[model samples]
Target: MYQLAPNIDLLFTEAGDAPDRVRAAAAAGFNAVEMWGPTGKDIPALKEALEETGVQLTAQLAEPRMQFMIPPKDHAPFYTGLDAGVEVAQQLGCSRIVVGSGTGFGGRKRQDQLDELIEIFTRGVAHIEGSGITLVLEPVNIRVDHPGALLDRTSEAVYVAKGVNSPNFGILYDLYHSTVEGEDVAAELANAGDLVKYVQVADAPGRGEPGSGSIDWPARFADLRNSGYTGPIGLEYYPTIDSAKSVRRIQELVAGR
Candidate 1:
């Protein structure tokens, strides 16, 4: 069975703050959880809860999300944030950090902007070199969720990852975003292969729990296994009902797998 990691930022929210959500995930029989960012989180308390519950954090986002969208775009904060994120990940025993390409730089060629990411993240990786952590660039869909996101296609993310050319750098294949963007799941997975370091899921049309939408979860899961992606799938979706009830469908699917 595939080990599923609930997004503490979205799921188990009724359990209170982020630290409390970690405990809630553990109680729900999930040994792994993921969150957005570690910047403003109560690190000491979060670490304590993880230790107490023995839950492993699957991943967290790099701080100053969408840094490029802001002015100057010197991107220095992104590097500093990467360092801070690595330290937080190390403290919590997490191994992956998710990143995104913000809006394109003014009037620049699309390919140029993408290439710029390759350079920026290459240097960012240098900051965390030998830390045994990975930086996974995420491609978000613009059709529904992010209207101006720079990297919207899996192939684009693959291109950036290849250009970066680091063992510690890869792409995050988000099933929901890909579906919303109308990419073929099997095709993208086949193309990405090992560079697909992390995966996230939410059903399209609503970005809700897996069973709450029209996505063929079982078929998607089959294709995922066929692609040989043996990583924790992050449940990054909004719950339409109680958190536990929202996860029932995923629980059944994971068990059947």
Candidate 2:
């Protein structure tokens, strides 16, 4: 079955509750939903929603929002959060979680910071290697969305994943960010190949629905499939129109249902 990962936080504003987002995605033909840190999630309610709506939690990002690709002085707290996220992932019946890099522009040497980041993620992989959950590091575009973010290039992200050197670690290649960063999506994705665990997208000009912006989504998605990415394609963009309208349009554009 084809899996579409809906961003509940961005999808069902009309429904108002987190569970309602899951219901909306399920009703709209999506089999999975991905969420940010488990901050406001109610486990029982989420479980009920999943059972009732038949939608699975495909992924959830870890909390506290520190840089994993650039080491900070207090990485233990971040590690603890990853450990907790693993337990949460186990609860949600998911085997993946996003590991975010911190804010842009640290007053430190680039190579030194990069080394520290590798060490932190290496330790993080060790902590969760026994578990089935995989930690995916995202490389945000410093040019448009985030300025001075450490992990910008696809090559750099691949390096980090290889440096971590565990099945539990990988990278998320978000198409919108890659477009903004001027990386050839097809080529970069082809290079990443099976190392990429998740993919997120939005239109280029407006960062809205896939077909409404400047991105040649059809070709890109074809490349994605051809490159052997069989995982859920994450609709992580902010809504340009009303949530329902935008989602419906995206469904027509991407899912053809």
Candidate 3:
């Protein structure tokens, strides 16, 4: 069965603080949770909460903000940010970090940009070679969420990962973004194969809780299973109702699958 990880950054808002939200997720019976970035969070306190609640931090942003992965001039800051992220991940026991391909560079050849991405991640894989962590490259949707974002397709992400050619580098296959881009989730997952290290989900049209939208959850779940992606599938959606209530159906659906 697929393990479910609630995105505390988007859920459990009534809980008041990051640590409190961690506790809230545990109270809601989730053993795993994820967030956006650790820069502003109280790492020590969050660590305490995780230990107390016995919850695992599954994944988080590689940097506090989006970092440009295309242009060679932007690599220095990206590396520094990734290093900092690794330190925080060590404290939180998180094994995966989400990374985005920043907006496309104006006037740059598409292949040139892709080459730069490959080179950057190649060096990145070496930087964190023995850190017991994997940097998960995420493709954002340009249509609704991130306009002009480079690497908005799963195929492109897979291509980058293949270029990196390291076990420590992988792609974060977010179902919501894939749906928004109008890509077939099953086919993408199949094509991506083992290069996908993490998965996130939200129903399309409204980015709301599962039942509030039209995504065929069971079929997607099947696709994930067939793809051999045995990682935590993050619940990264806004709650239309009570946060706990929003996840109930999804939890049941995942469990049944």
For every candidate, C-alpha RMSD to the true structure in Å: 1.3, 2.1, 1.5
Q: Which structure is stronger by lDDT: 1 or 3?
A: 1
- Model 3 per-residue lDDT at 47: 98
Best candidate per TM-score, number? 1
lDDT tens string, model 1, 54-78? Answer: 9999899998875574467778778
Which ranking of candidates, highest TM-score first? 1, 3, 2
Point to the candidate with the largest lDDT.
Answer: 1
Off by over 4 Å in 1: 69-71
Candidate 2 scores a C-alpha RMSD against the true structure in Å of 2.1
Mind sharing the TM-score for model 3? 0.96
Candidate 3 off by > 4 Å? 64-72
Clashing pairs in 3: none
Q: Could you tell me the lDDT of residue 93 within candidate 3?
A: 95
**Could you give candidate 2's per-residue lDDT for residues 119-161 as a string of tens digits?**
8788888887788988898888887778867778887788778
- Model 1 local distance difference test score: 0.91
